[model samples]
Target: MNKFDAIVIGAGQAGVPLAKKLAAAGWKTALIEKRAIGGTCINDGCTPTKTMIASARMAYMAGRSDELGIHIPEYRVDFKAIMDRKSTIVKQFREGATKGLEETKNLTVIYGTARFVDPHTLYVDKNDGSFENYTAKKIFINTGCTPFIPDIDGLKEIPYLTSTTLLEIKEVPEHLLIIGAGYIGLEFAQLFRRLGSQVTIVEKSNRLMPKEDDDICTVMSDIFDQDGIRVWTETQVESLSLKLGKVHVKLDGGGKGPASLNCSHVLVASGRTPQTAALGLENTGVVCDEKGFIKVNKRLQTAEQHIYALGDVKGGPAFTHISYNDHLVITENLLNGRHKDISKRMIPYCMFTDPQLGRVGMNESQAKEAGIDYLVASIPMKNVARAIESAETRGLMKAIIDKKSRRILGAAIIGEQGGEIMTVLQMAMMGKITADEIRSGIFAHPLYSESLNNLFMSV
Candidate 1:
């Protein structure tokens, strides 16, 4: 049996950095990964999708260049070229991450699938068909989640795409049908529609992005309508079958939509399932929730005190940033002897659509559910000088403020560069800057941030 001071299973965003830091702090570490060094973010999720989205955004803008007074005769999306670019960037990122792990002192990079044999022991089935048992004083589980495959009839017989496989298509889909309307489905819906595919979204929720406020969803719906992307809400996919070369999808529950549709491709983007099932947690004292996510305390420690769970495996927020932050919390609390609590952090996320939806803190629904007295401020993108000047006025910005404290509770931006604008507001919220200061703040003219002045003025 091989032994180490520490072992990190899954070389994901959290595992890579945590292993490096632990090794740098003088602990011998083993970083075991079943696949590529970078986890979903670099291999499948954020990096590749964002790269393709960038190409799609470029194609979208080139198609409308005439409106910008830059008349272009024509523009075409070379699907292979876009895929190649995405592949190139993904490879670059993976190579960099691999290099970082391999060069780190006292960190051994292992290629294998690891499962707990006990609280401090793991058995690895190496990729080379070899096996090894490892014991460490401390263990960290950073294994991320995978796309959830829903249980629809005839789904197994027909070929369907998940978020991971959708990126590997040989050609652009003729008609792309997506199963969910959350962040993943919406981003891909806009992405393929801009990439010249006939796109349709069938969501089980009553409306698109049910978590967002009604007005935000309305603006997003309007944007999708303008892009010619069809959306059916409160719908469920009953079954799927292959008819000729096309996939016949039978959907139900939409009030006024066709019972079924035939599409060249079907993407099941419903949600993700935690990657803890195969971790052999049953052999250890560590506990998992009903969803198979490892249960961890605020310090990210599992019930087995020496074992820690980080990132999507622990199951609060699934964003890449959240995973990286998990690493920071563990590193600080463990290495630096600081008592950093993971629960004290704010969660910020951005949906990378044409009009990006960036959110931080609480929204109106959460405030109402919590019974907090709140005031709202909102403005359309058409009212923003920068958005109108750029001819991309398709969404709005909304903010929720505490009525008693006059402080910004939460904010949402659904305009161009919405993520960046949302970060500025997040900083203000972090600093406890009151709504009055934001309303009267001097922001540069004709920029998206300046709209915050207009947004908060009405509050």
Candidate 2:
């Protein structure tokens, strides 16, 4: 039995950093993982997906060279090269994470599946088929969630892909049929479509980004339509089968009596489910919600106060940044004796579509649903001089402001460099910068940042 001051199961975004912090603070820490370090973000989620999104963007731009007044006769997309580059980036990130963990003194890296023998004690089934036991004064679970494979009749018998496996295709699929219309599915739809594949998206909900305001959804839906991406909302994927070399899917709902699609590939991007059942949570006082997310307090402590759960496993807003913030929250409370609650933090997220959807705080609908008095301001990309000059005029910038406090409430920027521009607004919200101050702020000319000045003028 190995005894340590801290045990972090799953060297993910939260676990790795927390382990490093604990070690640096002069505590013996054990960081355990069943797979590669760097978790989903570096290995499969953000890094690889964003690298491929960059390649897809290049493919999209090169194909539009003529529109940009750059004469290009022909250009080709090397699907293999794109995947290779993505793999290269992922490898570098993974290596860096491994090195970081190795350099941390007093931290032990263990490769195995970990199960709670009790609250403070865990049994690790090593990859080498050896068994080991460790007990720590404090334990943290950062085992992030995995893609939830939905049970549609006959779906499993045929070869289908999830978001992770789809990123690995060496060849651009002829026709790509996606199972969901959420962020992951939408990004992949645009990515593969721009990479020269015909794409179709099906959503059980009535609109794109069901959580967004109708107006925002309308704009994005229009953009997707113009891009020639077929969408079927209010639809249910009834079943699936293999026909010849292609996959066939049967669909229902959507007001159409019956619909079916035959595509070279099918991607299931419905959602993700937390990884907990394997951890043997049943053995500990640590309680998980009905949905399997570890129930944590504002400080991220489990029912067993000495144990904490972070990142996707804790369930709300499964962004890598959120997980990193979770590390901060835990480290602050543990080492500094300061409580930094996760609930009050501002979160910004981006969808890597061509006209990226960058969002921070609440939108109009959210504020309205909460019965908060809010005012909104918006402008089209075509009105922005930079967007017009760049010929990437396809989206809008919207800001929602609080009517009572006169502060910036929330913002959604869906245009070229939307995420970058949205960060400026995010910082404003973070600092409690007022709407009037943002409106009067001077910005450099003919840039996306300049649009910020115009976007806030209305409210």
Candidate 3:
């Protein structure tokens, strides 16, 4: 048995940084990873998906070039090239993350599956077919999540793709049927449609984005419709089977959709489930919720105070940036003698569709549900000078403001460069800047930022 000062299972965004920092602070550390370094974000999730989205965006823009007075004879999407580039970028990022850990002093990188033997002890089944046991004074579990496979009948017999497996397709799908209409499903729906696939989205929810405000969902639904993607809401996928070299899907509910459909490929993007069951948590005091997410406090500490849980495994915001922030909170509280609680931290996220959906803080519905007296201000992209000039005017900008305080509460930007534009608003909210201040603020002409001045004018 080997003993260390700290041990971090799963080398994700949170685990990597936390292990490095702990080792740098003079505590011996061990980071055990079952697969490649960098976890899902680098190996499969964010990095590869965003890279392919960029390629899809290029194809989409080329197809729309006629509106910009540019006559392009022909353009084709080289699916192999796109996949190659995604693999290349993923490899680069994974290599970089691995190198960072390799260079860290007093930190041992173990490639294996770790299971808890006790609160402070773990046994690792190494990739080399050897067994090893390590115990630490402190343990951190950053094991991330995996695509949740639903229990639809006949699903196991047929070959279906997941978000991870979808990236490895040899050729563009002829017709892709995606399950779920959350951000993951919607993004793939648009990207595959752009890649010359007949894409259809089936969502169990009544609206496309149930969490978003109605106006936002309406605009997104309209945009998807305009893009020639069929959307079926309040729909259930009863069963799936392979027939005549095509995937036959049985549909129920959502009266408008056909009772049966055929597609070349099926993507199961329903949701994500945590990778905690295999960790043998029953051996320790750490508790997991019914959904298998590790229960943690505001400080990210598990019931076993010396053991901490971070990243998607701990639930809450599952974005990569949030996981990185988890590392910051844990490191500051432990190494720097500072108490930083993430319960009140502002979270910003972006959905990379044709026109990105950027969101920060609460939306109108959330504000109302929380009983906060808030006022709303909004402007369409068609009204923004920059959007008009770019010929990419499609979505809108909306802000929720505190009624009496005049402070910007939350914002959503769904347009070209929406993520970048939303960042400006997030900074304003962080500073407690008022709506009047933003309305009267002078912004450079014909930029997306200028739209902020107009967005807040209504308030």
Best-fitting candidate, measured by lDDT?
3
Candidate 3 deviant stretches above 4 angstroms:
254-258
- For model 2, residues 1-459, the per-residue Cα lDDT tens digits are 799999999988999999999999999999999999999999989999999999998888888899978988888999889999999999999999999999989999999999999888999999989999999999999999998999899889987899889877779999999999989999999999998999999899998999988888999999999989999999989998888988888999657678888989889999999999899999999888898999999889999999999999988999999999999998998899996898788989999888999999999988999999889999988898999999989999998999888788888888999999999999998899998888888888877898777887866
What are the per-residue Cα lDDT tens digits for candidate 3 across 254-296? 6675588999999999999999999999999999999999999
Error of 2 at 265 (Å): 0.7
Per-residue lDDT for 5 in model 3? Answer: 97
Candidate that beats the other on lDDT, 1 or 3, i.e. the better one: 3
Candidate 1 global TM-score: 0.98
lDDT of each: 0.93, 0.91, 0.94
What is the lDDT for 201 in model 2?
Answer: 94
Backbone clash total for model 2 is: 0
Error of 3 at 266 (Å): 0.4
How many clashing residue pairs, candidate 1? Answer: 0
Residue 426 deviation, candidate 1, in Å?
A: 0.4
Local error of candidate 3 at 370, Å? 2.0
